[model samples]
Target: MAKAFASQGDMSEKKTSFTEIGEGLYAFTAEGDPNSGVIIGDDSVMIIEAQATPRLAQKVIDCVRSVTDKPISHVVLTHYHAVRVLGASAFGADQIIMSDKARAMVVERGQEDWDSEFQRFPRLFEGHESIPGLTWPTTTFSDSMTVYLGKRKVVIKQIGRAHTAGDSVIWVPDQQTMFTGDIVEYHSACYCGDGHYEDWGATLDAVKAYDPQSIAPGRGDALVGRDMVDAALTNTRDFVDSTYNAVKPVAARGGSLKDAWDAVRDACDPKFRDYAIYEHCLPFNVARAYDEARGIDTPRIWTAQRDLEMWEQLQG
Candidate 1:
């Protein structure tokens, strides 16, 4: 059996850590758990990336209440991943926003993703029964959209495909802060089972263009300064590049999937060994990188059975 890590009970009582990235912007992280951000405006608040369930979201709500009671008027989803969006209903925001492509992905494969993720990582979805259904966005835009919170401007843009086809980032120009959903992870493993390795590099470049002073990633510690921000981006890029390159030659030579996995372990295990979820992410990342290197453009849907099949094939 896989060795169990620390459980949520060990960390649940810990106070939610919120750091001010800019004047009125904060990043809420829970001891390397999935991250959620808050952009406090003059009158209302905009929350980025809801937690996994209403119960878990209540923790975030408590944190928000500690700061301001302006009422969370907007909830923005950087993508349609279950962990990032399933708890959206808890916020009771007037508007739930996402990319137009993200909304389509929700309609197309959201249910499949929900099942796949629940099976893959059971720990994150505490109180899963409370989730009403797949999260649907009340508003969606293609490319970019800018909303004014009173006078504060918050720009949401679909920079490029990285973590998912519909990945997005929220930029607060005044704050020089960016909330990059899963596009950039700090110490946490980059879950690339459904990612686009070829397009991920360019997406990182697009995120860099904003020159964010601070960044709230999907997981791990929030990047608080310029040096930390650069390091996060660079480390994430290295992780993705290594995974892709490790599997490329094997896929190109028509080697078996096992061959690609071996190559990936040899290339990445040493460096990424201590990162969170490294073991869980490696098999899936190698599988997707192998497929993409072999010219598979779209990622295959991951069902529970398919996950086990892939794991058995690669790691058994």
Candidate 2:
């Protein structure tokens, strides 16, 4: 391989921040790493997007303890990615929720994803031994489901497919604050390895329709205020658009995958070079875009070996 995956070399711990996006709503963010959301309810708490491993999850648990002592009654997973759902056990919530599609994905490729991600980003899986196995949802919904945390009304809905086939957003009606999983990222690059580029914009539209005043994004900082929320939404849309747009034309012209990679780099580097995890996500994003443009609807499963082969082909 020409070089290691960017994240593989990023072993230094990131500074974590626990910011309150709304009353009783908090976002635990670790720089560009995946984030976790906390919703403090009258009788219990609901956690959204568990981290990569139980060890990493303990950090989110610590943050939750700081603000409330209410027992964690529920954990809502936005997607089935290993980085997002593998830490569910640490929450030990009575109810673990996910979209039906997400649960299916877990059954289909959960192990492969876990292995692939663990190899791609070692730091995120610091406590891999602690992971009992694939995280399964105790409860699932097809389109939408509403959960009342005591008096706080939280709606979990699958707006559309973007980051993955089954992406859900948690909406707090009282505060108009949404906890968007990977469907929305802040400054962090969207990891499109298993994404649907065509449907991503529509998903963003669905999120935009909600007009969330504040958002606990999948990554980056807690989005507070309409301006900040809007900015992150717009920027996330642009990131997805630019990446797919650059690669689609190349694939349409029957260009090689390498060609698509170069095209995406030329189009996205100048604009997004400073974005978090830009380098780590670029190769996979370009490969997926190329596959999508070539009429491949379902993304191919990514195994640990596939990750290395793809990396070597693009970067070596």
Candidate 3:
């Protein structure tokens, strides 16, 4: 398993696809990797979740070119993860929008996260050198904000902290479509290294409240139709809930971190075993769950070295 971290074992690249979930709304998905959302209004364009680097993001831009010529006016980051925000500079949008909480995280751990994430998944950093620096949001909202793309409307809000300190999603009320950054994963693992598990469940409840017809998730494919959208959200909720459920008892009883990890793996791996990144995310997810279960309300920042140390501890 440690070796699994060292190498992805010749996993080939995935073919990218741009699917229209709503009128003039597109989801740029590349199978198991990170996905991006696109919204084209009469006057401009809005992109959700920038890729790892400018060169990598250019691929999404190229796909965008195939559809619309409207200027990319806004780049909205759902959270402050490095892989999701580093490419903001590439779009050169009029405004880089994000939640105020996410901005605070970027200010605190953006650099460490950049290094940590790049080391964990270097393939995503195709044009690392092209990134000017950490992506700083040009505009930030404390909780929610709405902007008009011509007559089209997009509501961006931080529903609650889930995958990160400030997880947000974009809603197109008229289209009944939502762009969820890392808050929802269909066929992918929910990385809980920086997640808030308890709040995450309530957060998923908040997501369901919107009743999105088509949802563009952070990874995996875009969920189309009510059934698929519900399945995605349910899967997300199950994963988060199960993580907490499996680890809480052990943690509350003062079990070792390894014990909690093993318990979670046993409880969750059987169900989510085949999902993308499941193996890679198990250790980190359990660690965070264990902390939260033991009453650690806030998540600890993970550095590259810290990641390795944690992996070694669990693997050893």
Candidate 4:
């Protein structure tokens, strides 16, 4: 039988875990589901990566309420993906911030992404109807921006691109803890459909410079110790590096996309096959890597229709 398309078979909900990785820092993660980070500053709170919809986001809000009474002042998007940004409205945050590139991506392909991702993972979009259309940023920054919730400092920076063109990571200078959006994943598959594979390695180098004592990645469990953080970073890099290395040569040899996909899947499976979303991400991962290797600098927008078409043409 032919393989199913992206996430069509992944409708079951995984258990959600909310962990405090550091003092005032929380990670709201579901087993393999998209995760969000919470930061409590002096007098206010900031949420990183909103869940998919208002109803779902309310669950995160409830979690926040249980711990801190500080109002959610900002909803920071580490990147522009429907699963990551659409739940912003639910937070009632005064400011919604994203890297300028990420905001631009919303204007360019927000609707298409909303539709594409919803169709791909119906389970994650449980409150789909509650979404108030495409989520927009109240503020945007280029290289980096800092916001203070009272006296605490939250640094947000666009550290190259890995998951998407306009990816950003939140750094807490004093604590030396970082919330690296999709740029760095832990024991979970990295979705490279909208990624910049060649530049991704360099971006990881930037993430390493922060030397975060703890890290809240875009998905999976939070990395709690410096050693664990480093391991996750290295593991993430290896995933991206292996994908590019396996596919780059296939493109260089003018091999078929299938050849590139098979090569990468075969090479990466031994290490990453058990990781979350590995199967769902493989086709898109290979497709994007092949494009990068063949000199396509930018990633193409993935529409719901295109997703299925790509699956049939490649995975099928």
Candidate 5:
């Protein structure tokens, strides 16, 4: 019989693949791990989302080096997750950029999130010690910022709060390709522990408005072609909606967290059971959804101890 439950710590295996998604654009996804995006321009390069550690980011650097010797002058943080931003030092990019809100999140919860995530997923942080403290953004924007990669335009915008309070997406208008950090996920489960469910749907709608021909999501494989792009957006929206709606009524009834978890699992498991990280994210997703349903505007901080306590309450 197949195993029914696995710890988050057990799924940290890394997978590295550099796939060319468009002209001068590539996606480096590590088997369900945090992904990094590469934008090769006329004279320089910009990397979106540094991996968890210097060692991991170095692997991506090696791949980028294979194509061009142009220096990586910019590193863009789509959000301030430890797994994504801690490796900024590895790129040695002169300017590390982020949305204004993302930088604030780092100041507010950077240390807590760092401690929480390192404990939960060890393998992702292959060289945790090499991470020289928390990553700080050198530049930040409120709504949108347009960067020129030696004449190639890459627009970075804070579409809305979906995955985190300060989520941003990088759009390559000429190529009709967008690199959405955690705002959009394909195949892999959406991590909603620090997300805003109501805002997430609106953000997805905004992404759809761009009509991207290709999208490199925060995780899973890159979506190519219009059909595939639409499918990815649709599936992500559906997952978020279904999960939120399933737990809303239970939360409204003032039901136990366990009850809400069961409600969401019953509704989502049939179709999403085989999806990557579905089982692992369900408990946390339901917890957040339940909190949101009760008019909790902000997601409570998730500490390492809180993670285990919540897991036991819902999964036990």
Candidate 6:
């Protein structure tokens, strides 16, 4: 290989911020690392997107303790990605929830993803040894499920497919605050290795339809207020569109994956090169974009070996 992944070289600790978006709703963002959300209901709390390891999860627990001593009763996972769900056991929540599709994806390719991600980004898995195993959801819903943390009404719904086939967003009607898993990112690069390019825009529209007053996005800063929310949405849309559009024509003309990668870099670098994990996500993004443009409806599972093979072919 020519070089290591950008994430592999990123060893410095990210400055984490736990910002309150709604009254009791908070977004725990660590610079551009994977983020976790906290929804403090009337009594117990509900957590969204556990970190990569138990050690990382402890950080979230500490933040939760700072505000309220309420026990974490539920952990809501938006997808089955290892980075998002593997630290679930640390939460000790009675009910760990995911969409039916997400749960199925876990059973199908969870271990492979775990290995692939661990190899790609060592920093995220700070305590890999502590990860018990693949995290499984105790409960799942097909389209949408509503859970009440006392008087708080939290709606978990599969708005559309963008980040992953099983992506779900948590909507708080009272505050109009939404917890969009990787479906919506702020300044950070969207990890589209498992993405749905064609369906992404419509999914963004579904999120827009809610007109969330605040959003605890999958990554980057917590978007509070409408203007900031809209800006992030537009930024994310442009990023996703630019990436797919850049690769679509290359694939259409029977160009190789390398060719598509070059094309995407040409189009996206000037605009998004500064985004978090921009380099780390580029190759995987391009490969998936090329596959999607070539009519692959479902993303192929990524194993540790395939990650290296792809990296060597593109980045190497």
Q: Candidate 3 versus the native: TM-score?
A: 0.97
lDDT of 2 by residue, 162-264 (tens): 9999999999999999999988889999999899999999999999999999999998999999999899999999999999999888987889889999999
Off by over 4 Å in 5: 1-12
Model 3 regions lying over 4 Å from their true place: 1-11
Per-residue lDDT of model 5, residues 1-316, tens digit only: 3233354446545568898999999999876778899999888999999999998899999999988899999999999889999999999999999999999999889988998888777777788889999999999999999999898999999888999999999999889999999888888889898999989989999999999999999988888899888888988998999999998999878898999988888888987887777766777799899999999988898888887788778656
For candidate 6, write residues 1-316 as lDDT tens digits.
3788788898899999999999899999998999999999999999999999999999999999999999999999999999999999999999999999999999999999999999889999998899999999999999999999999999999989999999999999989999999998989999999999999999999999999999998989999999999999999999999999999999999999999999999999999999999999998999999999999999999998888888889864
lDDT of each: 0.89, 0.93, 0.89, 0.90, 0.89, 0.95
Clashing pairs in 3: none
Residue by residue across 231-272, what tens digits does model 1's lDDT show? 999999999999999899998889999999999999998999
Worst 10 residues of 4 by lDDT: 1-10
- In model 1, the Cα lDDT at residue 178 comes to 96
After superposition on all C-alphas, the RMSD of every candidate to the true structure, in Å, is: 2.4, 0.8, 1.4, 1.1, 2.3, 0.8
Error of 5 at 41 (Å): 1.3
**In model 2, which runs have C-alpha deviations exceeding 4 angstroms?**
none
What lDDT would candidate 3 get against the real structure? 0.89
Q: Which ten residues in a row have the lowest lDDT in candidate 6?
A: 1-10
Angstrom error at residue 84, model 1: 0.5
Off by over 4 Å in 6: none
Task: Give residue 315's lDDT in candidate 3 (0 to 100).
Answer: 80
